[model samples]
Target: MKNLERFLSEHQQLTRRHFMRLGAAGAAALGLWPLTADAAPAAPELSKAIETLEPYFTPREKFRDVSRGKPLPHSLPDEKKRAVGLTRETWKLEVISDPDNPATLRSPLTQKDGTALDFDGLMKLAEKHAVRFPKVMTCLNIGCPLGMGIWEGVPLREVIWLTQPRENLRRVFYHGYHNDDPQQMFRSSLPISRVLEDPFDLPPVILCYKLNGQWLDSERGGPVRVVVPEAYGFKSIKWLTQVVLTNLYHANDTYAEGNNDIDSWLKTFAATISVPREVKPGEPMPVTGYAQVGLAGLSKVQVWIQSNAVERPTGDPHFTTAPWTDAEILAPPKHWGALPDGKIPANTLGFDDATGQPRTWPMRLAKVHWAALLPGLPAGEYTLRCRTIDEKGNAQPMPRPFQKSGNAAIESVDLTVKS
Candidate 1:
């Protein structure tokens, strides 16, 4: 309870619009009638509601092919392309001694002291203690492809435990099978603590063998790959072949060397407003889109329509002009997606106690679907904008001056209210 209070205080940006939704959810959980906004539920009621809504706050375990309905790309660098004879059946993961330390001998997994385990041996170990979870991977670059998949494999920590790393180890560095050329190699390292210290709230780091219930394909960093849910895609090394525990931190991230900020926090409140490019005056403008955040979770999505420019106060250079008129808050769909046989839908709305009408949308989800109706606008040019606020009250980034590594700004669309 104290933790919940602290969390709420720290993230006071949860708008009043979501309070009724949460309150009603809590009432429904207790088998009592849903409360109304005018009734003003107490803090305990809201807290209970939050507890009932906890499952949706985390990443989904079931995989949803959010590849935007396209096939995976096969664009590995020429040097890293697979050889004709190489396949998952033929690939082997190398557990080698720390290359950074000259005194260390090769092969950490062998009892013989200098030999490494082959693919079959590693698989046997992984099979004994496999874990699976769904994670969303996004690239650090602004427009890089995004993907979500259910990853199945052994936790990297378990693998490290098998090797029995020395107490003084400070880092664990790993890389995939790039060409023998050192300069062309793509490698990254994590602090030894990050790999070994499992946090209760975050997903475990894994060496994935299967994605979306299928053997990982080479194009998606297959045979073996790292899945680091907390960081950007660059941290999830692909085509993984080696794991080396070291006492030094390596700065080999290709994107981090130049313009990108590798340490940037994953953007949590980005949203895209989907609307028609043109609409006739006096006609209903149907709006729908999706919102996503990091582990912090989403709170609410606010929409606005403005015709005149206004001044901004957030101090973000991108948000130089402001004035916005509020639009109706949309409702969340009853279910995340079509449920399979024997599965039940997860309700996302709370019913009104008196009339039994739904009062609000479920906002505490990683991905939320939202829709709104705009009625009867005079013929003119207008910008329809939408922004998401995280559970911690942080606003989505404002688009204008490009940020190489920052939260994506509120999404907006220009429309001609035709006569």
Candidate 2:
């Protein structure tokens, strides 16, 4: 196997034009057509195209474990038992919107008339118009935890359309049931444009009922939850129960009051590497990890390895000190899953059909796997670092602004290259 450093050095000289031509040919070789670089498709055409490709989308096999550690707000002992006992027929989803006051954002899932829909109702709509897509959910608190899953559900636009918001409505506020505890309540808001429009080629916000072909478990915020493809997990609002259309912008998220950016998009292409903590010299080491971005799907990932002595002598320790030369761009998985001999699975929804690049949606969610081979090094401690380039050409923040917070920082692993 070629060492990662050598692999990177070889491709580093390719210009953008050369890279694109190669990428197009590579995709074609895999039986996938490059997206047509023409005028944007109309909404109806876009919807039809997405619907046509829905059945061919492929999901990753390994589901990362990211369970919320605390007892969920509504998860009392009896409530837990009740949740487990509830069937699709017994479950209900409420949709609420206060067009009059817009200030009284009470209730979990409310509507203009204060009516509720049973699970069957939700399923009926989803069965007819549901879309299947992959989305990466990362906590806003930075390195808290993250997970990627295939979500199936009705578009929030369609669901909200059923309520027929008043003409003046400008925003939508939503939250999940918290055992009727005000103190435990968590909520977030979205611009009405986001709810109703498909700007930036973003996947529609979904009221997801199923994940990876299975009904969601409570631990994963199931029964039903909102899946915001562009934002952090906080905006996804698990245990989702209420959606209130208002004319004013409101940030009610419990964490938003402090340092969290409630409306921020998941813009960083950060990664987590899986490597041995220690390795012997001359030993062949395989480096692997996953990379993700908010809306701008990943375009490239680069990995570098350097000794500790090559320091910048200033700036962030985790970042500025590394010698990034000879870094190699990691390749994506050759086969996502079992596709026909010459066919490719739809792996992302953020791809712009017109430009063959990821859209610049602030919260567009997508992820990809990356792997490389690392050559044995001389006896010394070394750092392995990885960074990602998004479709929009945004490079990972060097010495990331929030390394301590773990948000979008270059991922580094320390290892002893022993003799």
Candidate 3:
């Protein structure tokens, strides 16, 4: 079973690398709920929640439904997709001429905030450069973790470069669509160097136009959206009517406005993965789950396995004959984006903040899902847990001491078996 664990771990990292290579297209394929589906109209619960929180901090804007594109997947039949038709004509693309020029770009309808941009200006920017198609866009749906599309337009780096920022400009920010409401625009940010890098060389970031190869539906924020790599889905803002560049190093000021300070680099939370409870010892177990690098990339995933079992309904516990084994750390491949064929990139060696070794404290891997298996357990229940480290050597909080808004908590699953 240890061998099986090794195999599972290898494949999991591979899948994550595959995910990076696909970028926004991969996100589109991840899942896209049909816009026309007869979902119940908006509920009051959301507004009430937003209102209750208003007293403590700056008001936040409510996000609108902007996913109007078909999901990009290989399985769907051509007939199932809607025709792009003339709707495509209404949409246009844009690029920021100078990443640091930062005159400001926001929707024309926005009040004169000295930073709003109109569609015409956006198009003018795009005409100057070639915009890529099918970038991934997702939302951190509080109700349900789901993603969809709105054609995105912008070369992320161009906007970064436009700012003509100083070398210390280590962070990039993003804000979503909003009305007059304070929280109207969902805001987030990522490491500046990652996005500012050359996408063709590493393809760090890209914008999207069509979802599933069709024009985005208006309700789903047809005109434009954004896709970012090596990050959680939330950072990929939609209804991208605005692109702002600044030298300030800050998390989501919008989040700060909301009273809870959210770090731009979405922190990796602590989580767990258990060996499937249904499987018997010696049999191959299905190990699957997702992990994120916050605003960076995953570095390593470490698993701890013990033959001990906790007593059932009764309060008994006992260690198994197969004593706990040494911890296993599954290291991920160096690069997430596609690499030159035949060239194997080494994990960008790093050191744990606490230690100087290549490995960081609380282990970091570029991808997650490196497997862990307990072979030949005496037909008893066991536990499998994981901790993740990012390229920066930041580890997911095990019992995450504090309940930070963006903290990624470790997760675990139970294993039950009968021999």
Report the number of the highest-lDDT candidate.
2
* Model 3 lDDT, full chain set: 0.39
Give the worst 10-residue stretch by lDDT in candidate 3: 51-60
List runs of model 3 lying over 4 Å from the truth.
1-152, 156-221, 227-235, 242-252, 258-260, 266-275, 281-284, 294-299, 306-369, 389-395, 398-405
For model 1, how does the per-residue alpha-carbon lDDT over 87-113 read when each residue is reduced to its tens digit? 555555556556556214323764345
What's the TM for model 2?
0.71
After aligning candidate 2 to the native by TM-score, how far in Å is the CA of 341 from where it should be?
A: 16
lDDT on C-alpha atoms for all candidate structures:
0.54, 0.57, 0.39
Q: Give model 1's TM-score versus the native structure.
A: 0.68
Candidate with more favorable, higher lDDT: 1 or 3: 1
Q: State the displacement of the C-alpha of residue 213, model 2, in Å, after optimal TM-score superposition.
A: 1.3
- Please identify which of the two predictions, 1 or 2, would achieve the higher lDDT against the true structure: 2
Error of 3 at 123 (Å): 6.0
Better of 2 and 3 by TM-score: 2
